[model samples]
Target: MSIISSTSHATSNTATLSQRLTAAIGASILGACLVYFAGFSHIEAVHNAAHDTRHSAAFPCH
Candidate 1:
């Protein structure tokens, strides 16, 4: 009986871990899509923004 109960508990834990992993991966894909669209939609704007940011951070762009 004790072994059965422990096995059930482990199965539940595995299910929970899998669900969390799926959610995390979905969120990451969604975020990547958003960034890709935003950056690619206006290439010039994104490049200018990044250039300004680098200057602000004192990074030598030249």
Candidate 2:
């Protein structure tokens, strides 16, 4: 395998399911919090999402 392919395969074949899930969930929550607290940083993109357009929950997004 090429270096990139081998590195990708190794990374994809990690040992623990829960560990990976925890990492992914942690990253997502961190990202969401950053976006939530970034103060107008992503307003345009949020405004462009379908949920923000049609089914917005009672958050300050709209």
Candidate 3:
């Protein structure tokens, strides 16, 4: 009985870890899409803002 309980507890922890990892990956993809779109936006203000950010981060946008 104790072994069974411990096994279930480990599974629960694995599920929680999987959920957190999925969320992190999803958020990273969304953020990358947002940045890519904003960086290339036709709107000058948005494009410049992203460009400035790249410069600030020393990302070598040029």
Q: In terms of TM-score, which candidate is strongest?
A: 3
lDDT of 1 by residue, 1-62 (tens): 35554444444435588899999999999999866665456678876776687789998978
Candidate 1 residue spans exceeding 4 A from truth: 1-15, 42-62
Q: Model 3, stretches more than 4 Å misplaced?
A: 1-15
For candidate 3, give the lDDT of residue 56.
97
Model 3 C-alpha lDDT per residue in residues 1-62, reported as the tens digit of each score = 35554444444434588899999999999999998899779999999998998899999977
TM-score of each: 0.45, 0.40, 0.64
Cα-based lDDT at residue 13, candidate 2 = 61
Give the per-residue lDDT digits (tens) of candidate 2, residues 16-50: 99998999999999988865555455566664563
Sorted on TM-score, best first, the list reads: 3, 1, 2
Global lDDT of each model?
Answer: 0.75, 0.65, 0.86
Clashing pairs in 2: none
Regions more than 4 Å wrong, model 2: 1-13, 40-62
RMSD of 2: 10.2
